[model samples]
Target: MERTGTEPVTARSALGLRLVLAAVYTPLFVLGAVVFSLWAASAGPGSVPSGDGLAVVAGVCAALAVLAAVDLVVVVRRRRRERGGRG
Candidate 1:
């Protein structure tokens, strides 16, 4: 195909890539938060000394996961709009 300036150039979609990454990592983050929360909850008087630090970890992980999920949703919506809202 001869190069023509009139042709629409289709570049690789970084937004799509970001969406995939966010979607994939969101669940992992959520899982980590859940596991850490469970671990913090399981601490007993006879068990290792309880620390508020563990709960902090869980909260941070959960917050990051939610942000990632929101990012994924935003990217998906933007991509759809770029595609003329076909989706």
Candidate 2:
């Protein structure tokens, strides 16, 4: 019954891991997006160099945040279904 490395991951364990990862990353991405966005905005009013790079980074972060959020939602729904709504 020992699992080989090549064995496919079980749905439950995979989903559980995904749930944890999504939960952790969602917040981090959101925070990064916010911070970067603020920096990008501030550059416009300050003497700092062009905010173009910062703005691009912020956009990427925002996209990642949205992706993570979607992953989190999907994982939650799957876990809920796996629990048969009793949990």
Cα lDDT, all candidates = 0.83, 0.82
Deviation (Å) of 31 in candidate 2: 0.7
TM-score for each predicted model, relative to the true structure: 0.74, 0.75
Those runs of model 1 whose alpha carbons end farther than 4 Å from true positions after fitting are 1-13, 45-50
What does candidate 2's lDDT look like per residue over 1-87, in tens digits?
A: 367677566723688788888899989988998998888888865546558888888889889989999999988887787778833
Best by lDDT: 1
TM-score (C-alpha, index-matched) for candidate 2: 0.75
Roughly what TM-score does model 1 have, to 2 decimal places? 0.74
| Candidate 1: clashing residue pairs, number | 0
